[model samples]
Target chain A: MIHNLPPGLIMILGALLLPLLGQRLSAWGALVLSSLSLFAFWTTPDFHTVTLNLFGQDLSIVRIDRWSWIFGLVFHLAAITASIYALHVKDTKQHVAGMIYAGSAIAACCAGDLITLFVCWELTAVSSVFLIWANGTETAYRSGMRYLIIQVTSGVLLLSGAIIHFQQTGSLVFENFLGLEPGQRGAISDLGFGPLLILIAFGIKGAFPLLHNWLQDSYPNGTATGTVFLSAFTTKLAIYSLARGFAGLEELIWIGCAMTLFPIVFAVIENDLRRVLAYSLNNQLGFMVVGIGIGTELALNGTAAHAFCHIIYKSLLFMSMGAVLVRVGTTKATELGGLHKSMPFTTVFCMIGGGAIAGFPLLSGFVSKSMIISAAGHEQMFAVWIVLLIASAGVMEHSGIKIPFFAFFAHDSGKRVKEAPWNMLTAMAIASFCCIAIGVYYQPLYDMLPFETHYEPYTAAHVIMQLQLLLFAALAFVFLMKANLYPAEIRSTNLDTDWVYRRLLPRLFAYIGKLVRLVDSLFRVACLAMIKRFLNWLSKSCSAQGWLGSTWSTSSMAFWAAVLLGVFLILYYL
Target chain B: MKTKDDNSKGGNSSSDASWLERNVNVVIAGLVIACIGSLIAQLWWAPLFAEKHVEASHVEASHDDGTHDETSHDEHAHGESSHDGASHLHPAEFAVEEVFGFEAMFGFAAFVAVVFLGTGLRLVIMRDEDYYDS
Candidate 1:
């Protein structure tokens, strides 16, 4: 029975009991529930499907396979770490949100049918917003509302796509929509209307470029520890779904490249360190999208590996930023500097995350990102390879140096606060450890990939090229700083795609409303003028001075009437 | 650049700057050396790349003989491998990747270009801290 239980249901159902433990023990309760669920998930047999017969249709409510297993395991790890991160938060709502959010994401990845995936997708959307709203500020409330609308809209699209797919194909099984197998390539032409909508749904959730502003708008607004939970699940869930459903779509390559390139520039000028990380997260997803587009065994492995490592290091990065937010009360680069003096441990963890993300030799990024770049190189995609190279240096600039330098070192703002709370430190340390361990020894991660591959990441050619790329990028930073060419960290709002909805769309509606009111007032005045003219004529005629109102007018009226009668009689005689 | 001295006069427990703050030059020097070291490494590994290219077509096509093979290369691509003389993908596909200081130069140039672009972008997108609020 335990083996049959859905992998993430334990934590989802167990979240209700968390409040019973009271706020103090709820974090620990969350940790225990996730651990138990992980154990249950690990023991479930391969290719297992737990189904329910409802309305004469069999729904694969739970399925454990290679793809889902990797995601499931990582989701559990993230949940446990985030629970540790939030251990000190006495707010029961945050813990509940984190658990249900993490659980639904796990369940979403394991869902075997589109219907099951849709339910869990919406669940993740609904449950995760509380993490933002738990901040209990007006800005947080607004950002959370935006987040909820976009996410639920994506879920709605997913459901609508599934319904259409069911009507056309008579199957809701969540597999490749394009019917392409490993080593096969496909184009957007291969997709039907149903799958196309589903792809957009995935694209939105994955934060594909223009669809990405909700992430930057909402993630930074989440409460300190809450952002840690927010970082791990939702977007990665989209990556999993895309890999399962839309891998090998040709347009994804260009889309992924665009996704990778634009964000790094934005990250360069972003003030909020968390928002910078959010942009960095978007850039990393681009690499995975490119891999899925490649649609080869080795490329797929790279995607899986990159996702695993990214989850850990990203959580680590966010945890460090969260610690800064906790102590300094802001993550704005203009307001933060010299934090390492007081928070040495967080500084170290942040640097580790920075280095790993930069794809330093032996780090998790070097191991995983190289695979995708190499996959492109192997395909003889010279342009794609070169773009990936530029993006690597770009990653070095933002996550590697700018993040660590501005937040922890740079010029000291001299806010020497105490170290991060013990639980927070513990969580960051765990994530940091995972980053280093995976970088140095990656066979375990490789073993978890969906396919067998002898594709190596540590060849001398690969390492030297990667090192050359990152080191030179760092060298460039040093030169820029010495020359005072690096843009000074200024407190400013950087407008991105969110401006369309937040500013342009609202202003457009207001203008339309103003136009409607103007027309209404003009129309009312026109009608009133005509009415007043008629009334004026009636009032004048009624007065003694007007022809119809005067008593002598009766004689003239009788004469006119007689003339009319005589003309009528003449006409009748003729 | 605000020196460590400028920061020494703020808050409790920050009377003296840390070793890193006082030695910014050392970090720069270290980065330069590491960059040079990476360049030297490409030179050292150029010969290994040579041998890999000669045997790349067969070794990478289907199996690994343990001498740097990508065994999982797409089988479908084999039919189209007429030009590169290799059935599987290798790290050094283009002659540009094999240049001695190509990655180093590209990294430096790319970094500068992105930073400058970001500065230019700031002119267009950057706004007051309360731009949205007001």
Candidate 2:
């Protein structure tokens, strides 16, 4: 244990120090320092807890454990890669904000207590919004606000749940609490609202089915590099927390399946490639969530390994898309075509990413994705196995082929653009290398899993079977393309399940508003008419309304008080 | 409001586009053949290229016993003996329940295929210079 040196505090201090130096140097410096810190503890023993005093109690801020390290390692890699990609960006606010955002996530992973996690969680929320605002567009501003509200609300749930958990369990350890002891469970349920609050907290960040609007709304609108970083840490952190807390919860399996399949439909018709990726990102998280729900040693390992591979491949895909957006001033598939001649390198990198995401044999996705598939078969979850298999094919269609095919290799749109910058290319190369390295040398990764198991990812039969699936999926794509049996991208919107909330709910509110206004106006008119009639009658009865609308006399007040007192006495007696 | 593409007159007009349209199939087929052929070749020549090694080979075999209930003391010790043939309802398999649904899954796959095919046809039907524009 170290004194006066928690990782969160160190990160907060670094965030303050960044803008003081030159923009490029400070951003690079922060990335290097954070990477070094991560390296320092990469192989540290699991379950290493470090404490700090907060509010007169000992609080654990650094929970060095297998899970935290798993997330921490990837977060650092993302930050470094993002930093390298953003070397040309001149926005100081975005740079500083990105560091703080990345730092808070790292700190959140290391946070051993609920309060510490909450602090870092909200910090990430506040800091990352600047990245969206840095886009300097009206769309980005609105989307940033939406992103902020949702994120802060998720943080609020965390705080509320932490309080309830503390009151019940009398401790605030941020580790697994899905299945508590009987005494704790009794206390938890007695609070009545504990699980509900915690679920909502994880739900928003986890992007659980219908609760996943903020992601599609904000991600595409985020600045190019901002989206790259956004792709990496935030949602994946929610997934990690879910795994830590809600594993083996059966409800999550169906949610995961829905997540995997639903997005591909929208992504296929979606004009914006970045938004397509957001949908694709949602689909990928479903797999991890499924693994967590399985909660077996193999399933959990699958979740972790998937997260690891997903980070690199997803970021690479994002980077490639970002390059297109930067050069062509758009990522709309309809508007993009045949840039493979000019941007050959970008195209190659994108194909690698697409293949990886599609779970093609020998790609990063295949090895990790199979774990979830096999887990389903092992459990005899016939429905789930079918869905996952369908999702695998959907991935091939949308991300696997559509992304690269439309942006780089359709009919030549005659747009001549230079390749991505040296730094950007370097970053892509590193990420692509990691993707292949992980795919090809999966044994080392399997060995590093928390579970003690011997799993063979490569065999003649397994490879042959995987090839059959992928080859057949590719054939499907070819047949579909040849036959014109796909949905065309239209200028109009394709409604998602979010339509119930985003469009339908708002329209409902407006309809209610109109009705309320109509009723209120009618009531006001009736009230005025009634008052006029009463006044007219009073005027006739009392001559110029002497006792009413005119000056009130002490006699009138006394008379009313006498009547009120008599009525009060009568009621009391009854 | 579909505009007629003047390029329907064929490749004689524009050198760049004609060159690409003429060679696109050849290039794509070449790439496909190359990627597959290389991967197949790697089976013998590229040991380091394969994603899995020997240790991971046994993981599927042992996964059943290793994942016996955490609450069941010595339950894992019984191994394959305790596992009944009929009821394979292990807790670890619960994760995919949310991840897989029949109608939704099949629907998404079919939808993606249709969308890709539709877009590709759209490109052919209403070819435009600025199809990539926002």
Please give the DockQ score of every candidate, comma-separated.
0.42, 0.09
List model 2 lDDT by residue over A381-400, tens digit each: 77887777777777877788
lDDT of 2 at A379: 56
TM-score of chain A of 2: 0.89
The candidates' interface RMSDs, in order, read: 4.1, 10.5
Candidate fnat values, all: 0.61, 0.06
- Model 1 per-residue lDDT tens digits across residues A383-462: 88888888999999999999899988987786768999999999989998898899999889988889876556766666
Candidate 1's DockQ is 0.42
Deviation from native of the Cα of residue A416 in model 1, angstroms: 1.1
Lowest lDDT 10-mer window, candidate 1 chain A?
A: A453-462
List the pairs of residues colliding in candidate 1.
none
Residue A77's lDDT within candidate 2 is 86
